[model samples]
Target: MLKVTAIAAALLLSGPALAQHAHGAQKGPNGGPMEDVAGVHAELVVSGQTVAVNVFDEAGKPVDTKGYTGSVMVVSGGDRKTLQLTASGNALTGQAPGPVQSGAAITVVVKTAAGKSGQAKFSAP
Candidate 1:
């Protein structure tokens, strides 16, 4: 019983470390942060008034987002905005109603053409 209890505790402690090794964070080609979402990599890129999410496969190659849908929820201070994204080229692009706050955290939700869906948050750095 003691051996079994010890083994269980070890497994619980190592579970997250194993998962992190399997899907480590990556840097996307667009110079943005990449995060795992629904077995794919979602890169968040912001430029001027445009917000984009570039999708990539596990191999780090660009994935065609022809039918992928995405949205971004940004919260800064007391303001919150949810922007709808449109599939275009290799990314989902949206226009922010105003400038995104530097301290704001953004969360992206994506559904691929193959119907895989996931959401992840990108904290301000």
Candidate 2:
């Protein structure tokens, strides 16, 4: 029935497994790929063992992240790890379990202090 279908759609969109993967965004000021996440832009940067996500507004200007929390899910070959991020300066930062493998795929998920959530994905360079 229509009611059942609507309920299912709502649940699907609100579930943890539902991530709006934005892949067509241009590179950001930090030389990382930027994607529209929630109501802002998120740039994913991986260097050494650090995974950082820079948040920006729709205009690509850096934004404040004082109350934002985020995490990075890195997958390379058969290895996978989730890094819990901490807001540092104006970016959300986390430490990977090991060196980020070449050609890995990264997904950055973030939530504001008010509980607004969004996500962005990146392909390793």
Candidate 3:
């Protein structure tokens, strides 16, 4: 009974980690790849000519839209538009200068507190 209890506790402790590892890179709330950095959760979403991002705190609460900057490079009509993003609420939203057609590819570069930078890629549907 003692050995069984110890094994069960160990399995319980390792279960979450195993699940995370199995999922590898999982999608965030907005259906984009999410990477956890330090205490922040960053996600990227691409739709039409707009690429939106939402940042959340460690406790899954949305963070303020301040002190965070991002740039998006989206390919549309054989051209690329590099737009600077503006933060609103917990999201960073931006519009490409030109019309972004379907099946476009987007790359986002984000900088947060302490000048930490991260990148995410997305394909429009």
Off by over 4 Å in 3: 1-25, 33-39
lDDT of 3 by residue, 1-125 (tens): 99999999999999897656222267777777766543467676766667777888766688886888888788766787788999888988998765566667777677785678877666664
Q: Per-residue lDDT for 16 in model 3?
A: 91
User: Could you tell me which 10 consecutive residues in candidate 1 have the lowest summed lDDT?
Assistant: 18-27
Candidate 3 or 1, higher TM-score: 1
> 4-116 in candidate 1: lDDT tens per residue?
99999999999998777243355578888788887788888887667888888877888888888989998888888899999998788899998776657899999888898
The better candidate by lDDT, 2 or 3, is 2
- Provide the overall lDDT of each model, using Cα atoms, as 2-decimal numbers: 0.83, 0.83, 0.73
> Which scores greater on lDDT, model 1 or model 3?
1
- What is the number of residue pairs that collide in model 1? 0
TM-score-based ranking: 1, 2, 3
What TM-score does candidate 1 reach?
0.84
Better of 1 and 2 by TM-score: 1
Give the distance in Å from residue 102's predicted Cα in candidate 2 to where it truly belongs: 2.1
TM-score of every model versus the real structure: 0.84, 0.78, 0.65
Q: How accurate is candidate 1 locally (lDDT)?
A: 0.83
RMSD of each: 2.4, 6.2, 5.9
Error of 3 at 119 (Å): 1.4
